[model samples]
Target: MIEFKNVSKTFTAKEGTVHAVKDVNLTIPDGKIYGIVGYSGAGKSTIIRMLNGLEFPTTGSVTINGSEISSLKGKELREQRLKIGMVFQHFNLLWSRTVLENIEFPLEIAKVAKEERRQKAQKLVALVGLEGRENAYPSELSGGQKQRVGIARALANDPEILLSDEATSALDPQTTDEVLDLLIDINKKLNLTVVVITHEMHVIRKICDHVAVLDAGKIVEQGPVLDVFKNPQQAITKRFVNQETSSASLDDTTVVVSELLEKYPNGLIVRLTFHGDQAKLPIVSEMLRQFPDVDLSIIEGNIHQTQEGALGSLYIQLLSEHHDSLQGALEYFNTMRVETEVIKREQ
Candidate 1:
């Protein structure tokens, strides 16, 4: 397990001091994929660097298992670092080295026998599906393949934890998904604890079991992926979640609601939120069946799959000669564990 206890980091420059991370606290359980998400300058990279002792916190502690990484120094820090491996966004491989040689570089630093290193590298090559490319240099590989090499190298030391710092930002969407899936496979196969730092919400949605949302050096929100996605409390976090679902912004959604209200003055506009099994049920069809006197039309809707399950949101217009049934319909939806909000009622 990794714990960040009141951790904060600051950097001093000729200009002045900058606080890259604020008083943040987080716990990442072992064998699970955790994500730290934020925009540029949000201190996500600082957090990842601190994990392996590459950067020390200005205050508080970063502890893996029971060791406080911030206090370790010299040989102690180096030894502790060997247990934690890092994968970079740029695929930091030696251009002159072949795939097998690059993966063996860390084992060489540890003074492993050349033959043993070769065996380890060969095993890793197969683990990462780079079998035929073992003799190829970094230049000969695609973006996804290069990242696979980087991942294999990071695992050369058989580290317990792997830190990925914007590891997919440089890749195209398809390549990013490929790398992400590989990471998931590695996590399950090796039972390795993986921490990913990225600005992309899709990355979080795809693989992370838990997530921390950062903005301006402070964590605005953090929780299990499903809970955060279903009920985001902060404006920044909501924006990030919307980005993944391709949902409209609050203002834009309000404008849409207003236009719908103008077009159908007697219609009722409602917003529905679904979580888990609720998203899979045919709630709209049920509603129409229950209230045959009322006409229901979907204006806009989206359903997205996350690590937890399906999360969906929909905007619907309800029309009826009798308006009282709408309230009863909403109450029925509430009893079914679906969140219902009447955005606009007949006026």
Candidate 2:
């Protein structure tokens, strides 16, 4: 387990002192995939660095298990670092080294015998699906393959924790998904604790079980991935979530809702959120069956799967001759555990 207790970091720049991170408190549980998301200058990279003792905190403590990493120095820090492995965004690999050699680099530094290192590196090569490319140098490999080599190298030490600092930002969407899937597989196979730092919401949505949203060096919100995606509390977090699921901004949603209200003055506009089993239900069909007098039109809807389960949202407008029917429909939704909000209702 990793705990950040009121951790903060500051740097002295030529422009003066800059607070990179502020009184941040976070707990990353063992054997879980956690994400830290933020845009440029949000201090997510700083947090990842602090986790592996690459950067020390200016105040408070960053504790891994029971040890405070900030206080460790020299050999102690280097020894502790072997327990945490890091994967970089740029896929830092030696161009002159082949895949097998790159993966064996860590083992070599650990003073393992040549034959033993080769055995370990070969195993990692198979683990990361680089079997046929073991002899390929970084220059001959694609971006994703390079990252695979990076991952294999990071795991050579058999570290308990892995830190990914924007590890997939440089890849295309398809390649990014592939790398993310590999990470997820490694996590389950080895029960390795993974901490990913990225600005991309898709990364968090794809594999992270938990997430923390940072803005201007402060964590605005943090929670289980499903909870945060379904019900984001901060503006920045909502923006990120909406980008992945809604594909529209909140202002855009409002404008669309307003136009629909103008076109159908008597219609009721609502936003419905469904999760897990609720997402699989034919609620709209059932609503029409029960309320034959009402008509429902979907303005926008999207459903996507997460680590937790399927989560979806729908913007709908209900047309009815009677207001009581609409009220009954909402009550039914409530009882079914479908979260609903009235976007526009007649006074």
What's the TM-score of each model vs. the native? 0.94, 0.96
Which model scores highest in lDDT?
2
By TM-score, the best candidate is: 2
Q: In candidate 2, how many Å is residue 327 off?
A: 2.1
Q: How much is 139 displaced in model 2, in angstroms?
A: 0.9
lDDT of each: 0.91, 0.92
Per-residue accuracy of model 1 over 84-105 as CA lDDT, tens digit each:
8899999999999999999999
Candidate 1's TM-score: 0.94
Off by over 4 Å in 1: 247-255, 344-347
Deviation of model 1 at 200, angstroms: 0.6
Report the Cα lDDT for residue 13, model 1.
Answer: 89
CA lDDT, candidate 2, residue 100:
95
